[model samples]
Target: MFEYQLGIDFAKTLDKNDPLALYRNQFHIPKDDTGNDLIYLCGNSLGLQPKTTKQYVNQELEDWATLGVEGHTEARHPWLPYHEFLTESMAKVVGAKPIEVVVMNTLTANLHFMMVSFYQPTPQRYKILIEADAFPSDKYAVESQLRHHGYDDKEAVILWKARKGEELLRYEDLEQILENHGHEIALIMIGGVNYYTGQYFNLKQITNLGHKYGCKVGFDCAHGAGNVALNLHDSGADFAVWCTYKYLNSGPGSLAGAFVHERHAHSKTLNRFTGWWSHNKQTRFKMRDAFDQLPGAEGWQLSNPPILSMAAIRASLDMFNQVGIEKLIEKSKMLTGYFEFLINALKNEHIKIITPKNQEERGCQLSIQVKTADRSLHEKLTNAGIICDWREPDVIRCAPAPLYNTYQDVYNMVEKLKNILNE
Candidate 1:
């Protein structure tokens, strides 16, 4: 907390003292149709673009225009190895080693690639376990993997589900599922943070549990990559994948990240879909002879990437490196805590938080379950210049991202929620 001489103006004082407050200026915050700054609390869905992203992208455009075909080898960011430049910072953000991290295709594509290596279904252990409420894309990816392996999803996929009337996951239940059905499961692919409920699951525990059952373990870190401490390497996941377009602040539908455990780095027997990009960099230009997969995460890439998108990711990851993920997570805890405090002070039954109550169990977003559970509540918030996300059935998610959001934004959103509930 900012220890400073202050009066009752917690917001004004909080904003002035916030270490990351200056970051807000770096982003192009959205403005409503009426020309007012939208509260913009949806970073979990899509982060605001940094002003530097344009410059980074333009560098590529200029390189393409002037250098033409030479850009792959001669440009400022040399397209041939553009992904390597992002590896160090991207690795830092997710607690991975450089060799373990690679910028590659879209989220689901990366997920499938990881699955290809880690989710090797055998006759004795052929099932894949996942949280019941995982994002649809992940579900589809795994189901397809099951079908690809010549197995039926109904028999080969085990969904670790939340109990009836429960809003969050129970580690005990997950363990129980592993204890009972672990023999059938070939792999356990879980979301490090639940996209719907904003629950940050205990990754280390999940990994240990799956290993205890002799099953390979992986994580889908889509919601957790930038929002929480993933520690993918330490968590010992067989593989992990995440998108850059969300909290990472890259543009929409941008490139994704993948990580493979170091222990698996040298395994020549692991199956992978190889391409020119996956070949050893030193010999890739040779374009001949036997197929040689690069060690670690880079080995999974299938093709040359879109450098324009990689540039945006590079710009953002550099910002993350400067601010430091530990500091950002610290700020995230405080900012999200302040949001929780204000919302709880409302003491209104109409608005209920569905996210886990403990800080360790969550990140920045709070999933609000309105009593009325109507779509109009989201409409009301939208009209009031509050940018939040509404899920199917009944949940409005608001994320006060640590890099740009402030206590004042939290106050404004809570105030708007109060007015909407009153109506």
Candidate 2:
């Protein structure tokens, strides 16, 4: 019935021809009870750890064990300036310059830190604008930021909601919100991509609109960092932050990244909560009485970071660098497109995709709105060893990570899903 839809064997042929197929060997794919590979489709949540993560983290562990306090100066990866080792490669991943980016803290902490400098809510412009369906952590962060500035979140925060009966956000509605509240909105902090709908927002368009309205702009890129080309440097956002544990494949609950536009890098007077790492590296160990800050995003650092986490990042960044973001994205487009094709071929009318249909509007993830099916259907998929996630109210997000997922995996997933739905 799907002569053009291609079979599981055809997907295998494509995988054989894939230039990035070799990357699958670099990661440790999860296996099921019988020792079969569990088709992992949750890279949107936590990525598979790179095999080199152990080697990189071991370097730090050995240093801490042997050099102790001296590890800062004597270790293979010096603890004092350890984060510096990752600057170039990490910057490339998000299309940033070395000075524009820094890896530190967790996702929420970095958001709080970025807000300290960028959110600048004033008397006339005290409101914060965010997506109505933002991640719970982000909602809390913005709400608390409003409260911290002596404003009620109920009154001071504006939500850009998805249209009624629609799961996706529209750019036109965003334009309308900006036209209405642009003057009072202090900052436009949005997720570069919506997690639930798998929609990648138009960053440049949003940035332009917010800028035209005299509002500072920022993005929470947790879902966009590795899944899509955030083009953060070119997007003209005032600042952006993301966690590495997601599609970046760093590790679970890993260190996060923060970006500051170059224009604000040297703004020493920009308000921030600082610590020793944020201090000038030259003057940091001087035992000075004054609190001197560093330049660029490094100025946001609060404490000496966990080096082991940095090592895990370095390991993953190396993989990203070797594979190149552009190539990975290219493969992701094809691989995900193939998955979409196969699913659309399903004779069952019960499954519908909630993610945007256009390639430009999404990444690898597809939020399947299982028509008339309950959570038990997802339980069956899980039992069948399809490692996908089911969110509340009936949405299952499946991401075929370019770094490891193959076309055959997509074909197999759809075949099983078809069979189960039929039963």
Candidate 3:
């Protein structure tokens, strides 16, 4: 329904008609040394800081300074239930029920925690399946899980990889793997969105395939949580984990999110590591009581959270609540589609768009493979005031975040890329 043209005026026209266009101004766009706004297209790596983030975090700091010990209950947000404030909005972001979702530790840490309860392995079925290109942290976590359970890491871990000449994975291959190794596999944990190729997997499909094989299913949605409609509950995955620092726009090292399907909310038989925070809130302060596991995902908490970090997440989630993820995703498709249009229009054989072309199978990120080019191309782009990131070998990941990016930004980035490539 959209005809993409090549010009700044067309991009400006599109921006003028965009309902979320004004949201761009709500962020602090990094400026070049010359005081011009840098073309930031790295939301997949680190999102631009929301202008209100400071206010949200400072509110807590002021409460601590003024109330001291009383801040736990006397503060406006009530530190006693600080994480609860984030539950509804975060659940909305990932399309989950509040009881199924919780804001907890960092991403990899949360991944390991979820594995403890979900990755139950036995001698007959003890292998774990993951994407061949999973983020290094996930790979390490899963491998360690296998070794921790007295299995050889290399022998117990299975990689669902792309075909010999392909970069994207196919479900047929996964089905084949399960058909053969189904009995031997204990868990299937893959990135909901592939970090390097920007491919969005079908979570429900993966979960179904794993369940059919009698293996537990999980996803690391660090890239998909805020960027797509995850529908974690409907997907019926056993659990999922993701961080807030990316599209969620929380600060660096901010608290991550976790999801446990409602079916497992009160599964007392499931093994889990817990702390006082996971105890029943009503009697938590009693000090000398037996452990009463709080039902749902909240029971996974190991400690009282970092309020300052959680405050930043609260700020970002509030914006997400106002705009809604579905609306943001609609804009994301248009923004990233426009980005793809311009890249293809270049027709430069030296550059290839490695990410999937189908909007339904990808997020805002476009992983561009600069054929035969090295890090020098990335350096030149950085010098030209573009804030995209360079992955090792030959890919540059650029994401036009719907919350704070414009059509004009996409147009300008492509124009700059064209000029650089022509030179």
Q: What is the lDDT of residue 166 in candidate 2?
A: 90
Give candidate 2's error at residue 58 in angstroms. Answer: 1.2
What's the ranking of the predictions by lDDT, best on top? 3, 2, 1
329-374 per-residue lDDT for model 2 (tens digits): 9989888888888888875577789999888899999999987777
Error of model 1, residue 362, in angstroms: 0.8
Question: Could you give candidate 3's per-residue lDDT for residues 41-107 as a string of tens digits?
Answer: 9999898899999999999999999999799999999998999999999999999999999999999
- Per-model lDDT: 0.89, 0.91, 0.94
CA deviation > 4 Å runs, candidate 3: none
User: Candidate 1: deviation at residue 240, Å?
Assistant: 0.3
Native-to-model Cα distance after best TM-score fit, residue 47 in candidate 2, in Å: 0.3
Q: What residue runs in model 1 are displaced by over 4 Å at the alpha carbon?
A: 1-8
- Please tell me which predicted candidate would have the highest TM-score against the true structure: 3
- TM match of model 2 to true structure: 0.98
Q: Residue 122 error for model 3, in Å?
A: 0.5
Query: Lowest summed-lDDT stretch of 10 residues in model 3?
Result: 1-10
